[model samples]
Target: MSLNSVLPTRPIQRLSEALANQIAAGEVVERPVSVVKELLENALDSGATEILIAVEEGGEKSIQVTDNGKGIAADQMLLAVSRHATSKITCYQELSAVASLGFRGEALASISSVSRFELISRQDVSANAWRIKSDSGERWSALEPVAGKLGTRVKVDDLFFNTPARKKFLRAPRTEFNHIDELVRRAMLSRMEVAIQLVHNHKTVRQVEAAVTREAQIKRLGRLLGDDFVTQSMHVEFEAQDVKLEGWLALPTFNRSQNDMQYIFVNGRIVRDRLLFHALKQAYADVLYNGRHPAYVLFLSLPFEKVDVNVHPAKYEVRFADSRFVYDFIRRSVRDVVARPITQADAMRESPASVFERPDQHRQGKSVSTSFLAPHKPSPRESQAFFAFQQPVELPLSDVPSINEPLLQAYADGSDTRLASTSNAIPPLGFAKMQLHGVYILAENEQGLVLVDMHAAHERIVYERMKTQWQNQRLIAQPLLVPISLTLDLADMRAWETHQAWLEKLGFELEALGPQQLKVSAVPTLLAKADIAQLIKDVLADWRQHQDSERIESQINARLSTMACHGAVRAHRQLSLAEMNQLLRDMEQTPASSQCNHGRPTWVGLSMKQLDSLFMRGQ
Candidate 1:
């Protein structure tokens, strides 16, 4: 045969059976949370009114899910455990609009292959229930007849036992538990009408009863979120075309250290889409710090065809037809909801304490002295009166005192010193002339006109000062007359343990109450009327999110800065001419005054040339 006579042969396509199954398993079951998610979806798809999940050691050793839904048939038991087999979809067109939680039907097969699985199901009309066990699939067996309810129950043990590598990749029990908890939270939010209960290590971690109405669902969420959140959150609802977005948004002032609190769902499927996340960031742009995330439970409903939910293996991500429209809709909805005034009556009604309360207040009484400066103390009357009101106080910018004339004059003079001193030291080319427009100042440099963003600038200044104290390890601590005990999650306790010395160095006198709790006898003096519990929660949450030590510190610093900035005086309030000059002078002296902490310019300058150009004098 001639060398060129033979035609090119197509490459053979073959992957090892074990490897192929493992790959499939990886796609359907990424982690314990993935397995939980699939199981929950199956229950929901079957029209389950009540579902119970029991896990041992974060679902590492075992996981059992029981649901009061239509059970599987004896003949369908084998098919249920077969790959690519699903009852949720019948025809090819059904794939276009997938309303059910799961359609691939690979979850059961994937899960069973890696773990010892047992499934028992009984239909309402069937006299005999069916049971199947899959151990390596090669060896399958059926359970003897037994009394069973008209539903399905699945038990998975030794997850990833056949795949040691996968099991090795599993995080610590506590970390895994957090993931599982997050999954449950998302599912509960999506299907509020279904009663869901989660048990770990024989302890009930979460229990949500079926909600008859949307308002009841909101109430249940409030109970789960905590009293402070429920009291501070505002209701949000908006609809555009096929999309409807609804949820509760926490006030800008009521923010979390991390983005854990932001829960978003797409067409009843819990997902983590960056578009929605970015929209949230835009909605609370000026209100929150860069690293801090707002607390929200936004639910998005739209036609199935309008969204593609097959983006992620866990189905926690989606692609929208018009992402910008969705983003704008969410941003506007949140902004409008937050802008409206919240009433005390509404807050009280949503308060978690009103729904559930333990007979005994878990308050502790112990005192410890520290060498650091003491925490700021408020009057007993002030402390009592603060919590008495449920509504947040909305103060006008005018309420703040104007800058004194003498101070302004001094600042103006100081500005000259700054310009003269740094003229040679720092390049003038980088400095842009800024023009004050009402309360806003705009500056243009080589990069861009820096918008001084008055509030942000003031906040950065205060934050820098506070951070200096913290960095120098010279924080003042105030001892409490009575110690306060805090019950926290295991992860939080571990975080505290890891940073115990650092926290003490920062003027916090803490003691471990037990494995999952701590007692605080003192706090940093810089914080006025601080809620120790909330502060600890924020710190732990931040620590968990940013595992990098350096990044965590940076996030903490940013948070501190945001707090200082919000508390600082804003512009446009009637400031004395002198005060304005002083603020200007201060701006000239401060390093990086061109922009605020949020990367927005702190001031904008309108040069004489630009002003003349506007008047047709450029020629």
Candidate 2:
């Protein structure tokens, strides 16, 4: 076949400007939220400190955004709606370093192409605002003088009216509004100093005041996420290698079934990164149960030149200059908060009284005990508040704080009697009163009754202890008396070839007998009794596709968790009050002690107010 025969006779023609814009709209304007995202980004880029968003019929009918930002100049009115025109950046150097959330310049053009669009603005220097109108972005009206405030207002109506096919795909009003609501949430969180209000059909849907202080910020978070999330989350601020991460991480006990509550902002721009998300997953791997996702609102800030934000049309994905370093930084930073030993100060912060705190009194208001301000050494009183008065340790449990037996004696209702005396401060876990059915530990704290699952708590304690004991040592490889053989395909063979050293480091010894067959001579001592063949197959199967250390560690932990289960104290086994209290003390000090390895809650609290409510005491 001749090359000329394969070619088309006619040359391809350039697309019309209107068609080009509509095509761009296909990417930039997925739904009502897409338009809201673009407009809000523009408003923020304009240095707006206050913004108002109004929508009609889930934005299918109309969307109007007004911002108190430095308005556009009268001369730039036409170019503002034109394709590939933006004042945020002027050259390739600026493109490489996109400080503003919207730099692609396609958003306004793509948006105007598919809707009735109007732009009104009056700069600080202008005596009056100028207005420009566009219908499907093809023709624009000449700028006309109009009375307006010293800011900008962008109104979009009849979205996708020029393209019925796109309009036909629009979702239900409430559904589309929900998407818009979520998009606004990111915008609100992106700028806490900016006042934001959203109205739907003339009724205010949401509003947030400008948050200028730590207290106001926590209240804003509570209003957005919920009082429970606010109360149960902790503040995290970590910086290394010129990258700073500050945000809130919910306790493992306060996890979600889906990632609905996860929000990550990069330099005030909301983005989704698989590598960052995977790092988070690794951080919460051992803490969360299968199928459960952790909820967090993290903000990562680095130099403007270190990240590329122009990779996606919608600007949702970003590429970091050093993805690996970023990954490790996120993983280590979150893990330090997620998996550290709980201190007495931590328990005091989550005190029973904190349970009754108003929604506005969120958890993040409390500072972390660190050198972020100054190194704080807990006084003897701080650590000893858990006890009324120490009794010499006569019990068999090591490192267990023995308290006067009478100090543990509580009222029949499981409320502390000594705390009422005001002579001794109550501990976080309080004192163990008795064992219930050898399965639950009944305790009394200053808060109220606390019921703990003994087995689950003990299991977590032993697992964490084992992890610490083994943390510094290389995995000891156990040689098999008889080697197990397996047959593999080319992909699995390639995975073995690529990650053979990692496998060996994790305590696996494999030899390739042939291209299609492999023999395993040894495995980790921890997994000596595990189904070696199946484990290897499962790990290698995943290794062929996923090339992260998480997969290997997950497999190891699964085996280790099973081992810890066997080592933990058994359910339905009788124990003395001292033994029960010892377990409680261990739990208070253990990392992720609130949940077992399987993610089941190890303990639960019942505030006196809650208990009273059950009996209608107030009424």
Best by lDDT: 2
TM-score for candidate 2, please give it: 0.84
Candidate number with greatest TM-score: 2
Candidate 2 C-alpha lDDT tens digits along 426-508: 55677677889878999877667777888888777666655654443446889999999999888888888888898888788
TM-score of 1: 0.56
**lDDT tens per residue, model 1, 1-619:** 9866797767888976455667789888777877788898999999999999999998988889999999998888888987789998888677767788898888888888888989899989889777889774445686555568889999998889988988999999889988999889778877889999999999999999988786787688876776566655656678888889887777554555567678888777878887788777766654443455567887889888778777777777888777767877887777655433222122122222211223122111111100000111222332332121122222111112223433323444545322223222322222223436546444322222233455655544444444544665546688988888999989888888888888787778999878877898987665536666777778777556532123234445556655655655555544443444434434443333333556333433333454566578858
Measured against the true structure, the TM-scores of the candidates, in listed sequence, are 0.56, 0.84
In candidate 2, which residue ranges exceed 4 Å CA deviation? 1-9, 345-396, 400-426, 469-474, 480-500, 511-520, 528-547, 608-619
